[model samples]
Target: ASFRGVLTNGGRGGGGGGGALLRRSSSIRELPRRFSRQLSRRRSSLAESLPDTPAGWAASTAVLSSFALGYELRLQRSLTAPPLVFSQSNPRNDALRETLSRRRPGGRKGILTRDIKPSLWVGTRGTLSSAAAYALPHFGRKRRGECELNARLNFREVMTMGRDGASVGIDWEVPPEKYDSSLCRRKTSEERQSEILEGPIRKPVVLILHGINNDASFGYVRSLMRACTDRGWIAAGYNFRGCGGVPLTTPRGYTGSYTGDIRDAVQQICDRTASPSVPVFLVGNSLGANLITKYLGEEGYSGTLPPNVAGGVSLGNPLHIHSGNMSFPWAQVLGLGVRKSLFLTRDKWSQMTCRNFRAAFLKALLVCQTIGSVDDTLAPYLIRNDPVYPFAVTVGYPDAGEQYWDDASSYKYVQHVSVPLLKVTAQDDFLVYGSSLRKMSHCLECPNVTVVKTRCGGHLGWQESPPEEQREGEGRGFGTSSWADAAAADFIEAIIESRRKSDKEEEAIKKAREEEVEAEVAAARRRRKEEEREGGGRGDDDDDDDAGNAHMERRSTSEREGYIAARVAAAAAARREADEIRSRL
Candidate 1:
């Protein structure tokens, strides 16, 4: 039957109503499929008009996003959050600003306040801005090799056994062919022997510590590692117990406050490097930042830390654990991740000697709904009951939860951090309280510590719009998709360069001193020769001349001995003073 006739006359009769209705329903169902097919054809045409290949599409999307992000950033009224007010003059802050400015591509004119220009959308000033940071990757596309979440580089693993037989793994980034070739140099026989006895000249080490429940595999961590290696540095990531796919060697797990393994790993690195000249910069992200700050403060206060630790950079550091208000949702999510880690390693827990403790801990973990609850369950067992370094856990609170948070926090010992420390925090970081940062920064008396507060940069999410050169991977130069990584590399470079320059100046001074000493010795010898020629005359017999020569020789020897002894003593004193100064720096 014709379609129009069927609709109008109901299949030409009153009894055909049910058949017509059935036909109508079937037609209605088919309409959606027909429409979908038409839409697909149109979509295909539109996609062809845009970019056909995946790479081409990605490139186009990136270009469009960059333009959009740039516009948003430019339209913003204020670029940064409110400046942190300090009670005392903070020269370190000024120095840090200058360092960041200088390291920028165009020097001071690149950006205002700092080089880390947070993205306009994700970096908005809000209470949940930090939470937005985790969602940033979905909005913008990271470059192929930069901040790749799934790409795992082949890193050489170094395992260090702690005092308690537990192990911490360090994944070292293998340098490119260029770095290896560049590192090669001719050495003197003595220098070669010294290197053989000690170790090869180590590149300045930049060791990264990941956040809670995170590892070397994290995109951010790997990106930073890549950034370091790009700068010709020895980059490494420190994995906590059972992290980075390493099996848990012991029943014990890691806590924020438990820095014993970190201490051991660093000590091992220092030992392996042999030369104290090889600088080691410890960079910590999130929980790792807190760990580093606490560790540095503790070591700096106690005077047990190594001097080769040149500096520290703490990103998204939770200065005071209790100060920040973590949303229940975030807390629960983090708790779940922790629980998952525990579940994956349930076999290891089963082997634990304390059966009752393991049973209760596992049970508590299964029900943990917040990070606070997780810490409360984990801290006492990991730290207070630690078999290796029980006495090391000193920071405490009356309540178990408070104690875990307080002990883990860097707030207590932050003032004692002696190394040149760059503490970067975002005002909008959800995990960290801005007030705590402000208060801590205000009270900070350590001239070596610098606190940088950005208006945006949610948590560790300092993702900025990549510059044209960087986006194209052309002359990008030692940077990752992350602004924090770039800033850190620049800071480290500035420090290393400054140190080298200072060393060069000192060397010049030493050379000048040596030259002056030689000149004085030469002048003295010349004067002695002149005096001997004048005093020994033509009127003297051979025997008299000989006796006179012998007397003058003895006098010359005595004078030379006096000069040598005085110079040696002076040189020794100078060396002692220099040693003291270097140690302090």
Candidate 2:
């Protein structure tokens, strides 16, 4: 029956008896299928009229949403509204400068995370996706254009490990056997790198690092890239060895603890993408989190950061002390399974993988000297080789235990950090252990760290699709994190404001203290004169005593007030600038 016929009959028919009612119910059941088919046909016609492919339809929708949201946000950010404020004065965009800095910042350590991560667990299931303008994508669409893909790719080595010259590579996908000719440099290295940084195109780049067993073109990578792009960021992920279309440049694939490789990769990408002043944000998830945290901490101590790197975000990191330990065991078991599946035994896997990159990994493993307690049982792949097993056993660690608690620990780095940082994690992540994460996070001393911990949603799973019909245990929520809206973009912008305001507050407090000291001196002089006039000789001594005590208290109070006032002044400045910027816009 026609969809309209069911509709018309359902609306118009009169059921005189129970039999008639039953008939009506049967017809109602069939209406749904007919209605769906009719709706699909209508939608297809509408889609054709709109003039784009299915992918384009999604892209267009995302763009229009971004534009509309951006326009509204810009409107709200009017130049004459509250001035965007910051302590550091940027005359060009003073108003916007203020709007960015006022956000609170702090990060929970990756090590002490179990409890804190729960607050961020967005439920895993909802209308996985729908047709509404701001609707989430169902599983199907997220698989395709999340990441732009060409056949395959690889990169030149940036660093070597273990003095043995074993090459280590860490990326989201498998390294392609042959590096793409298009990606090769015919130009001088400097010119090529410069071109990548100052591109023929201007786009906000999100350099992504992957977790265990993942690659650049995986669904998660694509989703994040799409989400970032949807929110107006140019996102890309690189392949590690043996995971995506790429083959292992070295015989062995990557491990979770590979910090040097990831850092070098970031440095290279920064060379390619970040101009001296272009904002660069580092984003890492899960295993990538451990590597990134260590990288940031190390960079913090080194005191030399690439000026192009603006900030970073670490999500669902394996920060718990137990994480690395667990990973070794887990990978050993997996290696066992994979070896059996691939018909390679422990003895053979060593001789085979040890040839090239395995040494680099083992060298990198030396950096994790704390894991001395890990034991030979976890070294399934290396236990056989006297060469490999002995190295694992003899490796020196920064800490006494083997969990890598101190080397990659973000707690120590917080005090040294000045960069803006965003830390996202799930509390209920059974894998990472919430308690350890919380301990580490609570101890991180950086004022620029913002820890967002959810109560549900295991691991990288978070959804922000209108809340009600969102997915469970998915990162769909963080996907909408683009600068199209104030909140999405503010994390990066806020860090800039933080430094400026800190400087401003310190200045204001200095001024306030000076004024207070001057006032105290004047009052002291006035009281001395009054005492001489009133008490003669007796009033002089008593007055002197009173003056000294009062002066001390006043001076102390002024200093305190000065510090507080400086912060207040910075805040006021920020507000005025933001108001002005908003008003103008």
Candidate 3:
């Protein structure tokens, strides 16, 4: 029977209701297959309606091929994609698990492990999408929007001399209540040197190094300064030469390879407080972070770092400079979009007055078209055409060969860093490629380095979930309260605390060793005195001599056992301290 006829019969029948219902159900199930066949027939009819000309055939084939290619590409991507473990568990939890597992007894010593779990809101999935959302606010207007909280913080700007005689601006922001009188009272260079010789000051100072073309006025910089101030730290944002809206004194601006300027800036900051031993921690973002890492590695290996530098926190650092430069095409695509948006909104690019600077900018714009073109065109142009202040080739990039790339990369220097270094990076940073970052991750094998890799957070863009008590119509600020900012601060604090614990452990171990040595020396003197007394006897009885030897052997055995026990205890204590430090981080 026809499907519709069976259904009508099922509704009409009362006596054979069960039989009619079964037939109706079977007919309903077959309807989909029948409809599918009809759809196929319709598709065939539609295809037949098209012209039989070569152009029509070519257009149809092209359309199908494009769809097939897209489907294949999508399928390949899905197949190769790494599973998002964050869906089941937080990335922090995974880090914690890994850290704990790695911290077992007999593990490698001197390596500091840190875990940071950024609180992301639900539905914030996909690295690229999250990065785009985070970077959405900074596209237009070079000037960052000033939040009331940031504006309230009192900032004083001071000009310091760079290594090349260029003036560098340092924005000093100290919490009003915790202001140090010594910092306020400017002393002569001689007096400052004298004070440093005495000892480092007691206050904690956080020195911030901004990225290329950025200064203290940048929202992120201000946010970092404010966060430091809130934590009762002396926040000093060091603006690279010619970056703080001021032309360079020597026409030469900062470069990734040059670290002398950073060293000079750090020295100037330390001098301001007249404390060589003050607890100073460096915080650097992007290029600034890369420079800091390079400086730390170089100075650390040379043992020339100022006594006050405790450790550092580097955010969105491109440690592999050559690799990063090689990935310029990806950076240029995102960077150009942002630049274009800014250009359309406000003719910001047109405001350039300096000839050399304009030329550099134009070269950069020209090189943005491709990846290798940056190194071939812009790099060479910058090196050769610095008419005002010639590029100092000997400072950082001394060679034009392969050595130049090696020397410029910070990855090679990571092994030499002596102090704790916390490196924070994101998987989807537009300016930095994941592959380049992976190359740098190898450096994290060092004991003093701790790397925190988040699933999302575009270059220096780490936005967290809004707070529970957020006011109506008030959106989250882009900088001061970002996840990256909080993570940096936490890592710094953890490093400081770990250092203190380590110092205490060392002191205890030292004291134990000293006591053990004194005890051993006393025992040796006693043995010597007993030997002399025994030797003084004219006639030594054989039985007496044998007894004395036995006693001496027993004492020696006891002393050796005691020494081993003490050493074992010390090792256990060290292990415990290491575990505590890892947990805290």
Candidate 4:
């Protein structure tokens, strides 16, 4: 599915420093740097040429749509914007369009990323924000908002540094168009019996998720997917509703809701696929990781296991639920999905939901503009669509009095978990502060949870590239290590081993109980026989000399037999365990 366009000479694609030169040249060439300075000073309004309304915006989109489209990209009008004299030629306009495009259908933005940030106090037992009186909930703020890492052609993925180990991958998924409940129900029923999912994916699946305003095909995801698939891991991506034309029945667009959809999708994979012993690993970036962390934590020991859901790998799982809501301050940096969960959510609103709900969805879609106040920033969300949950208590069901927050928040369930989780984060990630990422390590007392934070990788952007590439350009400088593959493979392997150990332990316990019961039964039989021999012991006075001697001997023999039985059972148990462990190793 690689596009065949001959790329112009650049350093980005490994033309050495050529890409950097080309980028600089392109920027300079694009509208002249002189114009950049002067143009801002002499601003022009869209109204100068056309009215800022829906019709005008539609006309503008019509013009832009005429241009060629990438395999994963298409031009369209912004639902929140009205018809206006918009042009792709506008620098800021292009950036906005690109952001929207990332959130589009069939490709781009991740649907399962986390949203909403709340901070609970560390030791005193209240939310940190409430104690700090942090109005905006921005704790770990950085300088850079976005990071771009040039992927190595051979690996075809992004690499980022982590705390204990380096992990890497490209994560991508296209949103599906049209999600009719009837269709999902039919599919769900079909899934029950068993159905083969037809697709180009033939390798073992390694699911990947992207972040806010970015689809599965975003740079990091694309690189990781290509990398994993090439290395024999089947790769797949998913999109939120609305963005991929899945169409949300609810008026609200996609927000980072920790639904069990990913778990369902994994189950679907197990039910539908036939790759025996193939490990299905989950990976998420940015907010996607946030959602994943919450999902995994909520899964605890009680979450349903997808047959092949061996393990999970998360990059920058911003566990600071309450604090991650703030856009990174600037330079600071940091760090699955399921299907039954998918039907409950979406990417864009259909303008049919209740006003409050509409505002929530819209807030998710629109990035904050500080030039505009928080009230103004939230205005689009408050008025555009709805969004929510309760504080202190477990999150209730959506559309109900209580949201499922209490049940879904990662912090709430980290201690009750049974699976292995690996997290990679950038130290400078503005979205997820390194301190917070580091603190997660403390919360997860179990050895199963591993949190790795690097000096960089900021906010799932993992901007740091390789040393050579880091020397190339501004955005290219941040060197990111490939932590996804190692973390993923390691986690899955650990799960396989853990499961085997559990099985062995259970078997040993069963054998020991069986031996205990048998020994007890045999002793009872001997005692009964002796009682009959002593005339059912009806004449107790008959237990004189000879009878007392016989009974004492029987008691001694019974103790010895019981000891032997217990020893044999224990020995058998130990042997079985040794065999199991040896085989796994």
Clash pairs for candidate 3: 110-447, 111-447, 200-277
Looking at model 1, the pairs that clash are 81-455
- Tell me the tens digit of each residue's lDDT in model 3 across 35-142: 999999999999898869999889989999999768655543332211121111344333432443243233321112322223333112335333433333322211
Better of 3 and 4 by lDDT: 3
Residue-by-residue lDDT tens digits, candidate 1, 438-478: 44753267767766666666677765545443423311222
List the candidate 2 regions with Cα displacement exceeding 4 Å: 1-202, 251-253, 323-415, 441-443, 467-490, 493-585
Q: Please give the lDDT score for candidate 3.
A: 0.57
TM-score of each prediction: 0.67, 0.45, 0.54, 0.42
Residue 317's lDDT within candidate 4 is 64
lDDT of 2 by residue, 1-585 (tens): 554455546545542354456677989999999999999999999877784578978988998998876864543333111211112233423443334433323321111121211111123221121111123332323332233342222233223443223344333222112235657643444443334444532345566666655555554554554444444455556554344544334443444443545555556556654346455666776666656665665465444566666677676665644434455454454344333322222232345533433443343343232233232223332211111101132233324334334434444344344466556654445556454365554424555565555443345544332322222322434333111112234544444455457669899998997787777767786778786788654565566767767887876898799999999997787567446633532
Query: lDDT at 398 for candidate 1?
Result: 40
TM-score of candidate 2 relative to the true fold = 0.45
Candidates sorted by TM-score, best first: 1, 3, 2, 4
Highest-TM-score candidate: 1
Q: Select the stronger candidate by TM-score from 1 and 4.
A: 1
Report the lDDT tens digits of candidate 4 across residue range 1-585: 112212345423555465566577777787677787677656654337765799988987877665433311221111111111112244333333333233323332311121111111111112221122111211211123211221211212222212112222332322111234534532232232122253323235667776654456455555455445333355666553333323343332334543434544555556545553455667777656766665555454333445556556677665554422444432122111211122234333434456765554345334333311222222233211111111111222442211322222355444434445666654445555644554574445644555554432334433212222211121211122233332344344345545566679899998996676556655655666577678845533343444545655676689799999999997787567446633532
- State each candidate's clash count: 1, 97, 3, 118
